[model samples]
Target: MRETLPILRLLSLALLAGVSLLSSVALAQEEDGLDIGEAPVIIPADPADAGTLQPSPSNPAGATPEVDGDALELDRRVRDSQPPVMKGGKISPDGEADQGINIYLRMGTPLPELPPERPFADEPDDAYGAFQRGLFLTAVDKAMPRAQLGDPAAQTLLAEIMSRGLGVKRDPKGAAFWYGQAAQGGDPAGMFKYALILMEGQVVERDKKKADDYMRRAAEAGNASAQFNWAQILVSENPGVRGLTMAMPFYEKAAEQGIADAQYALAQVYSALKDVPKEKKDRAREWMHRAARAGFDTAQLDMGLWLVNGYNGPRDYELGFRWLSIAAKRGNVVAQNRLAHLYINALGTSPNPVEAAKWYVLSRRAGLKDVGLEDFYLGLTEEQQKQAIDQANRFRRG
Candidate 1:
C-alpha cells in the first residue's frame, strides 16, 4: 500500500479536477456540492423548536407567549429583498467590495468641492453626422474646414479620423490634441474617449487620477456606459473588502436607463444576495429577462439556470431548456453542460438523446469535458455516435 501511494495521489488529483469541472454545470447551493440533479433544500425553521419568543420591545410588559409572527415575517421579508453583494465576481452576501477605498475616504478629514462644470462644444456642420453614418472621406474633407475654425465636434471627429487613419494619415499626437480640445469643451463623449486615451497613456501622458475624475464627470452626466465602468473600478473580489454594494446604486441607475450590461449586473447582484427579501426576486427576474432578451450571453445562461432551478419563481423546464439551448448554441460552456444534464435526465422537458449528444459534443469543443461527454456517450447508440462524429467533421469544415 505504501508503494502504491503515489499512484493513488495522482488518481485523487485527477478525480478532483473532473468533479470541479462537472460542478460548474449546476447552480451552486449550500451543502450539496453542486449537482444538476438537485434543487436547494429550504429547511423551514419551526417556532416550537425555536423555543419561547421574546416579547416585542415596544410592549415589553404584556407579552403574548406565542412566537412573534410579525417579527418572523419582517425578518423573512428582509431576507428576500437583499441583493447579493459581490466584488470581482466572488460570491458574498454582504457588499464589502471597496473596504480600502471606504476606509481612506473615512480617514480623510475633508472632501474637496467638485470642479466647475465643463461646457459643451458648439455643434459642427452636419459633416460629423455624415462621418458617423460612414461617409468618411467626404465628411473628413468638410470637417477639416470646420476644425480649422475651432469647432469642437469637428476637432474631435477629425481627431478620430486621424487616429484611425480613416481617409487621412494616422497622427497620434495630432489626435491627442484634438481630443483634448473637444474634452475641454465639455463634450461628454469626448471626455469619455479622452479619459480612455489618458488611462492607456499611449498617445498622451498617463493620468489615473484625472482619468477617474473625467469618468466621474461623464457618469454624472448620465452616460450609461461611463456609470457602469466607473462602478466597476470601486468593487473588489477579495473577502472582507466591500463588494458590489458600492456599485449597486450606479448599476441600478444605469439599468433603469436600459443599459443591458447594467441590467445583467443588477440581476447577478440580487441573485447573490440570498439574504434579501423574496420580493426582490421578481425585480431580479425582470432585469435578467430584459438582459437575456437583449442577447446578453451571461444573463441568458443565468436566467436559464433560474428557470431550471425554480429560483425566485416557478420551475418551467420547457422555458428553461429553450433558453439553455440558446445559450449553449452561443458557446456558453456552463449552458452546454446544463443542457446536457437536462437532456440526459429528461429534466423540465422531454428528453432527446440525439440533441443531448450534439450538445455534449459542442461542450467538449468549448473545452468543458466533464460528465457532459461521459453521460452523452453512455446515452448514445453506436449509429448515433457515428452521426455525431460525421456532423462534427462537417462543422469543422465550415
Candidate 2:
C-alpha cells in the first residue's frame, strides 16, 4: 500500500534556515511500515469492501433461483465443505496439513526450470512512435510480431493502442489480455494499466483485490503512475480506515519522481490538513510551494491563498497575486473568485470596482456564481454598470 507524508507539519525557521527541506517521501517501505516523520501507519482502502463495488457476473441479479426453506437447507447440506487443513500427524511444521509432504526427501520440493531470457531488444518497433507518426495500422502490425514473440513492451503498446482506439476499433477485452500478458512478464506499466481496467471494471469483472495486488506490484517496481494510484487509494479517509496521515510517504515518493499530478495532489493534501501541528503546516507549505513552482493550477491557487493570507508564513501579496492571476487566467474559477474577493475587500490589493467587476464577471462566468459583484455594480448609474457588465460579459465569454 502507498504511504503519505504529513501535509500539516510546522518547523521552526531556525532549524531549517539554510537547508531546503525539499525531501519527498517514497512509496517503498523503510524499516518499520511507517512513512516519513514517524507518522502512524494508515491502512489502504479495500476495493471489494467499498460501497461502489458491483455484483460479480457470476452472481448476476436474478441468476440464483429462489428456494423454500426446506430446499435451501437441503442444498446447504449437499454443498457442505470441510477445511483443507487437518491437525494431527499430517500437520506440517508451519501449521496445518502439508500438501508438499515428501517421504523421500528431507527438504521441500525442487526448484522449477529457469525460463529462457528474452532480451529487451527483441521488442518490436515502437508502436507509440508509429502511432505518433499517424501510422496506426502499421504500428499494430509491427506490434503483433513482437506480441507473438512474448515481448511485454509490444504487448503493452498493442493493448494501449487498442484500448484507446488509436488505429482500430476500441476493444477493451483485447486490451486487457495484452496488458495481462505484459504484466505476467513483469512489465510495471502493463501491470498498472491492467490493474486500472480491473479497478474500473472495464470489459471484464471488477476485482478490487486483484487490482490492489497488481497496483502494489507495479508500485514496488517503481512505476510512477502505479505509485501515484496506490498512494491515492491509501491516503483516503474512508470509514473504518485511518486518515491520510499515513499515506504521505507514498505521495512524497511519487512527487519526488517528478509526477506533476502527484505534486499537485500532495500540495492540496497538505493545504487541507493545515490544522495539524506547526511542523505539519511547514511541511505542507513546502509541498505546496513545490507544486506551485511546477505550475499546477490547484497548487498555484492554494499557494496564492497561503501567501496572501500568511497561513504558514509571512504575507507576500505580490507573490500571492501573481500566482492567483496565473491560475485565474488559466481558467481556474476558484482563483478568479479569490481575485475578485481581494478586489472587493481590499484584503491583498487596492479596491478598484472596475477591476473587481472584471474578476467578478470572470469568476461568475466560470461557474463561481458571485452575486455580490453584480449587486455592487448595480449600485452605480445604469449606463456605467451596463458598460462594466458588458465588458465583463465579453471577457467571460472569451
Instruction: Specify the highest-lDDT model's number.
Output: 1
TM-score of each prediction:
0.63, 0.60
**What is candidate 1's local distance difference test score?**
0.58
lDDT of 1 by residue, 272-303 (tens): 55454677646888898998887766667767
Candidate 2 local lDDT, 156-183, one digit each (tens): 7777667666646666667777787777
- lDDT, model 2: 0.57
Estimate the TM-score for candidate 1: 0.63
- Residue 286 Cα positional deviation in candidate 2, in Å, after optimal superposition: 4.4
After TM-score superposition, the amount by which residue 263's alpha carbon in candidate 1 deviates from its true location, in angstroms, is: 1.7
C-alpha lDDT (0 to 100) for residue 247 of candidate 1: 65
Q: Which numbered prediction scores highest in TM-score against the true structure?
A: 1
